[model samples]
Target: DAGVTQSPTHLIKTRGQQVTLRCSPKSGHDTVSWYQQALGQGPQFIFQYYEEEERQRGNFPDRFSGHQFPNYSSELNVNALLLGDSALYLCASSVTGGELFFGEGSRLTVL
Candidate 1:
């Protein structure tokens, strides 16, 4: 079975720009979570989606948002990007509250 997958492996954006990253969850998975990993720091949860509904969110600002589709694929969107927003955006999938399987991650660089 295929693992999680993310598109646009790398991206470059300017401050105030918006970007969207996409992901396809692992087979048989139904929950998707998004994370941001700044250089030298561990992943920080952004939000989680299940059953096409957002279930939990972290300390991130409203500029961070996500969507999960019926097929369990997901998208992460960041608006008004800032230089500090540059990081490895990760997508993880699993059954609700279960162990997570992570994607290769989408790297975003804001200038």
Candidate 2:
């Protein structure tokens, strides 16, 4: 079975540029969650989508937004990105509230 996948293993951008990252959830999974992991820190939840609707959201600003498709694939969008927004964008898929399976993530670098 296929596992979760993410594109653009690394990227570089300047301040105020928007970026979009893609993810495909693991096979047989229905929920997809997005996380932001800064250097040397654990991943922080940004939002989760199930059945194409947002189910849970974390303490992220409005600039952080996401969408999930019927196939359990997801995309994260950040507008007016800042230096602070530079981090590893991780995508995790889970069936319940316990552990989550994550993708390698797309590392965003703001210069």
* TM-scores of the candidates in the order shown: 0.98, 0.95
Instruction: Candidate 1: count the clashes.
Output: 0
Candidate 1 lDDT tens digits, 1-111 = 889999999999999999999999999999999999999999999999999999999999999988888898999999999999999999999999899999999999999
Error of 2 at 16 (Å): 0.6
RMSD of each: 0.6, 1.0
Model 2: which ten-residue window has the lowest total lDDT?
Answer: 93-102
Top candidate when judged by lDDT against the true structure: 1
Model 1 clashing residue pairs (backbone): none
| Clashes (candidate 2) | 0
